[model samples]
Structures are given as structure tokens and as C-alpha cells.
Target: MKSLLSSRPVLWFLFLFNLAVAVVAPFVVDGAQGVMTAVGMGVVSLGAGISLARDRGRRVSA
Candidate 1:
């Protein structure tokens, strides 16, 4: 798990894939479930992508 998370390509893939899920989940899922699906995936995508970017910047500069 640690090795996987540290891989930039893998993170990029997960970030994009989850972002698509966040966007499409609302239409595909139903009712409140759709909201949950969207929110959950959205959070994960944003968190992973943005945090990775921030960390990268910090690491590169440091």
C-alpha cells in the first residue's frame, strides 16, 4: 500500500478515475445514494490529487 501510494503514475490514475466516478456517480446512482456516491468519490479524488500536488511541490522545493 505504501509503495503504491508513493507511485506518481498510480496516484494520477486513481485521482482521475475517482474524479470521473465523482462526476458520473450522481447520474448513475439513485436518490440520496447518488449524493453520497458523488461526495465520497469527490472527496477522495480532490484530496488525493490536491494533496499529492502540494506534497510534490514541497518535496521538490525542499
Candidate 2:
């Protein structure tokens, strides 16, 4: 798990992929629910970004 997270490309890929999905979600959803879908995605992406950052910091400190 630590090895995987230490890979810059993998971490970046996960971050971008989640954000991209969030952006595209609005188009895939129906009606006025698009806004809600987008917001939810944004939250998920943000959390992932934070987690990735913390993982990197731990690696650096160690």
C-alpha cells in the first residue's frame, strides 16, 4: 500500500480521475439532480486529494 501511494504517477492519476468523473457526472445524471451529483463528486475528489497529500508527507518525514 505504501509503495503504491509513493508512486507519483499513480497518485496523480487517481486524483485527476476522480475530479474528471465529478466533472462528467453532471452530464450523465438526469434533470436538476446534476448539481447534487457534481457536488458529491467534488467532495469525494477533495477527500482523495487530501489523503494523497498526507500520504506523501508521511513518506517524506520517514
The lDDT leader among the candidates is 1
Q: Which candidate number maximizes TM-score?
A: 1
Model 2, 1-62: lDDT tens digits are 97886477776776788789779888998766887877877887787688788878998999
In terms of lDDT, the poorest run of 10 residues in model 1 is 5-14
Predicted candidate 1 versus true structure: per-residue lDDT over 7-49, tens digit per residue: 7887788799999999999899899999898999888888789
- lDDT against the true structure, each candidate: 0.88, 0.79
What's the TM-score of every candidate structure? 0.82, 0.63
Which residues of candidate 1, in runs, are more than 4 Å off? none
TM-score of 2: 0.63
